[model samples]
Target: MQVRFWGTRGSLPVAPKAGTIADKVADALVAANGRSFADKAAALAFVEDDLDFATGRSYGGATSCVEVDMGEGPFIVCDLGSGVRELGLDTLRRCAQEGRPKEWHIFLSHLHWDHIMGFPFFVPAFMDGAKIIIHAGHPDAEQALRRQQEEISFPVPFDWLKADIEFRTLETGREYEIGEVTVSVILQHHSHDSYGYRFRDRDGKVAIYSTDSEHKIDQMHDENDFAQFFGHADLVVCDTMYSLADSVSMKEDWGHSSNIVAVDLCHEAKARRLALFHHEPTYSDADIQRMHEETIRYEELTRDTDALEVLCAYDGLCVEL
Candidate 1:
């Protein structure tokens, strides 16, 4: 199985301002510093090797959608944020070229607008032969989505969509087999209650998708529960939307975790790889890169017997399991 992040931003989508781009350009030029590039390849190499990620690349602006592909079949995704529009277009193109039916299985963390707003723009949902199955732990998931598409909110009504869309309410703690993947959910700490999902394939490869969930640092809970839940998982996608200081202070009840908390949880859970997700929208690419570096340093400082691989997720990142 493979995991792809279509969007990684939290809260909402954001774009770099013109001033931000100008700064990157100025920084790059300063880094070049009187060097003469013989050709485009030389300049490209300089950009790739010498310049920092903030100057050369961006983490992107799309909010919270991910794709989990299990070989060839229907598609499984998490969230339907602004990024899903691009995913929808890509899926539609692929289906058209391969002569395959459009089928999508989407899991929602919660009914948050940033997470569900892309559904209205999902191209496949407007197609006649497409089939969309929306899964959520909340019983009001369907109604919440429908309300967004009502006359006053959106130009098109939910009932007017031509696709066959169904909503399924998930039962927490119970595993359900969806195609070749075994999926189970757990209630997470969030307003209106969100869900964290664990997916285990037939080969026993595991991936946990946990977003919009906050972890309590001061409170003591049975470590065994989380350890068993994340037990030997190959990858854990976690919310690291704030700094530890912010998470504990001003944003105490913001329903988002910090990289410090994420590292600690994945370490205790014995998860192999941790992907920092649900990036704070206000953070620039450089800020996130610095945070990633700091998280790695923190992990080293707190390492126990085992080593955990850590990475900061970005839009368009692909991981094979």
Candidate 2:
């Protein structure tokens, strides 16, 4: 199974300013310390491996889209955030090269505007002979999508879409066999509620996608339920949108989690890896890198029988198992 992060931002999309880009360039140059690489490959390697992620690359600004491949049927996508536009174009290239299917199965966590805003710009929906199957815990998913494409809101109507689109309601706490994978859903705490998904491939490799849900820290039962949902998983993509102080005090009940809480849950679940995801929009790449470093340190200090590998998700990052 391969899980690729198309978008990693939360709430909304944001772009770096000119000064930020200039700063990265200056930092990269200073880190070189007057040494020059022999070739472009060498220079690129130095940027990728030596420099900090904030200086060498970006965490990206698109909101909440992920693609999961179980090596059978169509690829499963989580959310349809702004980054899905690029994913759609890449899917076109993949289809041309590997003869992949034109069918897509998109699972939505909720009916938030940021999560579904990219549907209008998705090129595949404008193409003929394409099939799109959208599944969500909310039965009103279709209504929300159609409303977004209304004449007053968008120039194109939902009925104008060329691809055949369908919506399916998913029951929480039930596991469904889809293609070569078994998918389980868990109800989460959020505005109007949200749903987290767990996917187990034929090879028994597991991946959990849990975002837009607030985790109660003092509640052992809630923690246990989430831990079970994440048990023995290869990867757990969690919402780490704020500092612990912010998540608990300032943004309490705002429907988000912190890296501290994520690490604890993953540790309890005995998961192999935890990918910090759904970055706060106001945070810079440097802020996220610092948070990532702090999370690693926290995991090290609180580790039990085994250590959980910590990863910060960036756009275009691919985790293969």
lDDT of 2 by residue, 76-155 (tens): 89999998999899887787788888888898989898899999999999989989999999999999999999989999
- For model 1, residues 1-321, the per-residue Cα lDDT tens digits are 999999899989999999999998899999999899999999999999999887888889999999888866788999999999999998888787876458999999999999999999999999998999999999999999999999899999999999999999999879988888999998888999999889999999999999998886775264456657787889999999999999999999989889998888888888899999998988999999999999999999999979899988988889999
Q: What is each predicted model's overall lDDT from 0 to 1?
A: 0.90, 0.92
Identify the runs in model 1 with alpha carbons over 4 angstroms from their true place. Answer: 36-42, 98-100, 220-223
Best by lDDT: 2
Per-prediction tally of clashes: 0, 0
| Best TM-score among the predictions, by candidate number | 2
How much RMSD separates candidate 1 from the native structure?
A: 1.5
| lDDT, residue 44, model 1 | 93
Cα-based lDDT at residue 74, candidate 2: 84
For candidate 1, the lDDT comes to 0.90
Error of 2 at 142 (Å): 0.6
